[model samples]
Structure formats: C-alpha cells, structure tokens
Target: MKKFLVVNAGLAALVGSSMAEAGFSPYYAGAAIGASQNNGSEAQFCDECTGSKFTMHKKNTGAKVHKVYAGANLNPVWGVEAEYANLGDTYSLDMYRPEFGIPGGRAETARARQKTRGIGLSAKANHRITRKTSIYGKAGAFVWENKNSMDYTNLDGINEKYKSTDRGVSPTVGLGIEHEVTDRISIRAGWDRTFNTGKGDRFLELDANKNVTDLHSVKTDTDMIYVGATFNF
Candidate 1:
C-alpha cells in the first residue's frame, strides 16, 4: 500500500510539471497586417416601377487591413479576445452609360468607393498538435461602420455625388495556426471572414423635380488572411 501511494504521488507530480511546461499564459497582446477581399452584389431598382431593376455582382475587391488585439487564456483550450481592425478603402464599382443617339456616343461615368472599420469580441478554442504548435478556431461578433460614396456624371454634363454611412453588427469566424517561439512569444497565421458586413440602407437617385427615381443597395462580405506575433505577460 505504501509503494502504491508513492507511485501515484510521483505520477501526479509529473503531470503537474507537464502542465506547467505547456506554457499557457494568462494574458497576451498581438498585432497583424493583411489584405482583405470584399465580395457581394449591388442592386438598382426604379422606385416607381416594381419590375425595373439592375444588379451588379462584385468579387475580389481587394483592400488593406490591420488589427490590434488583446486576450486572456482561460485555460489550455479556451480564451477570449477583443480586437480593433482598420479595414481600408475598397473600390466598389464603376459604371458607364453610352448615349448612342448622339452624333458621337457620349459616355456617362459613375464610380463608387467604400471605407470600413470595426471592433470585435471573440471566443477562441485551441487544440495543441505539439508542445510548440497549436491550431485554433474563433467565433465572434463585430460591430462595424461603413462609409460609401459615389460620383456620377450624366450626359447633361452634370456631376452628382452621393454619400451614405451604414453601421451594423456582423458574425465573424476564423481559423489559425500558432507556433510558440518562446514562453512569452508566439507567431500565428489566420484567415477570418465577416458575413454580410455592410447591409441595408438605400442610396436614392433623384430626378430634376427632387422625386426619388431609383434606389441603390449594396451588400458585401469581407475575408482576410493575416500573419502576426503575440507576446504574453
């Protein structure tokens, strides 16, 4: 019985030492820089006619993004993080309308641009593949602000500028791999996507009499790939 107790105590101590060597930190901070792609569609409809509509599809509209984050590890497999991200400007679309009835076709041009930023809170789950390497998945909600602007020139040689701001919360999901370089430092690469980030709000095109003629709406999802390093305290 005494020998059995001694062996059990030895095994318990060994397990405790292994847990200590796992390098779980209570708090950490990190920064990342990456490129983002915006994908979605824009629709234009005549306010007066129910069936008159036009739709434009957008894909791979690229932008630059950067994020700073801080988090606490609750245990070996769970953590929570808060982050602020600057999602740079993206060119939404360009449209040209040609007037074929004129002696020489005159083209009317329209262009759009969008700027976005957000803050998010996430829950992270980790699986250790080895002593120094782990893979993680995160799910979160992001509150974002998007600013959209359009410049249009018509056949009458008149330029019209329309601007709108939209704010909302979006669901964010990500997967990442991390490798520990030291007890206090780790490097990671990840991919994150925010769904239906900028939705709702309609931009109205008005006629000369100030009557609403057409309504335009844009919706998009944002995807980002990033590499970063974190320091634990």
Candidate 2:
C-alpha cells in the first residue's frame, strides 16, 4: 500500500507542473480597441495662413482605436506577430487671416476626410513573471497608407474638392503586459506609436493675384492606447 501511494503522488506532481506550463501555444491571435489621437497641423494655401489652430480625429465606425493581430511563439521568450491598425478619422478646420484676403474677405472652411491605416510584422520578446502572466516589447516597421480629401469653401460660396494619398514604411515600437484568463485565453493592455508618418499633401493653383483658388497641403500622424484579448492554439 505504501509503495502504491508513493507512485500516485509522483504522477500528481507531474500533472500539476504540466498544467502550469502548458498554457502558451505555438500560435495565438488577439484583438484590441482604445483611443487614438491624430496630431497633424492643418495647413492652408491660396488664402495662405501662417499657422493653423485646427485639430483632426481618426474616425472609426466602431471604436476610436482598433487593431487585430496574430503571432507564433518560437519558444518561451521569442516570437513574431503581424498586426493591422485602423486609424481612420475626420475633422474640419476653419481659419480667418486678417491680412490673407482683401477687404471683406470670405471665411475659409476646410472640411477634411482623413484615412490612416497600417499593416506590419514585428519581432516580440517576452519575459514571464509568473505561470499565468508576462510582459513583452516589440519593434517593427509598418507600411502605412494615408489618404485624405478636402473640400475648401470660400466666403463667396465657391467650393473646390481635392484628393491626396501618401504611403510609406515607418518604424513602430510598443510594450504591454498580458495575463492568462484561461488556459487558452489571455488579456493585454498596451500602447503603440508609429514614427515619422507621411503627410498627405495637395496643392492649390493660384495666379499672381493670390485668389483663394483651389486645394492645399495637409499633415497626419498616429498614436493609440489599447486593451485587448488573445486566444492561443
């Protein structure tokens, strides 16, 4: 009876250890939503303004900030992940320059529709703090596309429409903490920012007369804070 009891105790210990270490799979997927801010100064032309006091927002149908990603765990500490971010939003900026137009110059209105989206792959490194929790950091390059349109309305009620597109590769970095909620599920909260984004700019055509004729140059960028969940397989 004593010998049988000793064998059973060893098996129990082995099973418990296995359960504790079995949560991380070779593959995983996750999704997150949070707030994103678009920090691009609105620039004006034709009716030339020195500085613009206007702001823009990234418009989304669901959350202000959203992202979806999937990755593989090469081992306990290293892996790779690919992500897609929806940074689409809109805003309008109106400026009045006392010296820009002649006497009784019309108000300048710019109704802007901005679109910013990105997809990229990153190398992730992990550090386990406990059996169920870990913290990680990643660095990668994202090929981001920025497409925007603006409708300029003059005081005289003359309107002009223009479209602009900008696409390039930008360096991205982020850090986060993740905890296992269930054996195959986990939750994470993180912040990620891309650097040196493109400014989708378009220009206006004006004669020497300096009339508020057509379109102009504009700028845009990306920043976000997110909380998300993941599933392992």
Whose lDDT is greatest here?
1
What are the RMSDs of all candidates, in order? Answer: 5.6, 7.0
Task: Tell me how far the alpha carbon of residue 150 in candidate 2 is from the true structure, in angstroms, after superposition.
Answer: 1.2
Superposition error at 196 for model 2 (Å): 1.3
lDDT of 2 at 122: 94
Report the C-alpha lDDT of model 1 over 50-71, residue by residue, as the tens digit: 2322223333556668999999
Compared with the true structure, all predictions reach lDDT values of 0.74, 0.69
Task: Please provide the root mean square deviation of candidate 2 (C-alpha atoms, Å).
Answer: 7.0
Give me the runs in candidate 2 sitting further than 4 Å from their true place.
Answer: 1-22, 42-47, 51-63, 89-106, 199-221
Against the hidden true structure, what lDDT does model 1 obtain? 0.74
Poorly placed runs, candidate 1 (over 4 Å): 1-20, 42-59, 89-91, 101-105, 201-217
Per model, how many backbone clashes are there? 0, 3
Tens digit per residue, CA lDDT, model 2, 84-196: 98765522343443225454654655665556688979999998888789999999998887665667666677788777666778888889999999988999999787765
